[model samples]
Target: MTCAFILGAAVWPGGRPSPTLERRSLHAAQMYHAGRVSRIMCCGGLGRNAPSEADVMVEILTGAGVPRTAILIEDRSTTTRENIAFGLERLGMSDEIVLVTDGYHAPRARAIARSLGIRCTSDSPAHKARPRTILRESGAWLKFLWQRMRGI
Candidate 1:
């Protein structure tokens, strides 16, 4: 099964970028650079206050040597839920999907993909905020649980 799917990286405000974001970039770059994915499907949309995350990732990947056309952008996803729902259709049976994000997002991301019938593994970048990130990711998990509770 050559179905390899790696999630796109992240960007920050001012597009100043984050260490976590760079780790996301490195994960994608390594996958692409290693020839794990023939074409990459970058997923993410603009955050409420930030520019399009997919666009930022695309710029970095292309600059790092992934061909422009080889990178596909799923630029409509505003949340990790959308990342799965929209990303699955965009990818369409990625033999293997490595959900890339900071350490904490792993659980829900896999669950979301499975809900959409997209089986996946993960590729979490080493966290810059390992301790704080755990808390943040924990908070994210709570938010996800709350979203499910609210049925959003």
Candidate 2:
């Protein structure tokens, strides 16, 4: 089975999904509708928002016509590494996975998955990265590299 792992993004103050989060969930829904993936796993925890990122993702996926039974929730991950690690542990060692997130975030997420011994592909929504987003992602890349170098 192929699973689309939808990584969490920011949730707005009113419990709404940020545009990036919505796009990621929608892309995963499309993958399911297109038969590219048989299931989806939403990965995230509560941030500054009331409902967790995974909860908002589930709302988006279901609203996009994907059934609840076709989705799995990993609602305790607050970072990319935890997202992949926790989700993979829940999924076991069988199904192939496709990481779904913003383009700027995909590389780090993929690398994290690889470091965990997971060979997976990735897909991202078409999003123009704002300068702030790019800068933030750069910092994230540095942190990821630092963690890898330290074997953390």
Name model 2 segments beyond 4 Å from true.
Answer: none
lDDT of 1 at 45: 78
- lDDT by residue for model 2 (18-95), tens: 999999999999999999999999999989997999999999999999999999999999999999999998888799
What are the Cα lDDT values of the candidates?
0.69, 0.94
lDDT of candidate model 1 versus the reference: 0.69
TM-scores for every predicted model: 0.80, 0.98
Residue range 28-117, candidate 1, lDDT tens digits: 777777877666667777765466777777777787888887777788887777876777778667356677776677787887776666
TM-score of 2: 0.98
The TM-score of predicted model 1 comes to 0.80
Clashing pairs counted in every model? 6, 0
Q: After superposition, how far is residue 6 of candidate 1 from its true place, in Å?
A: 5.4
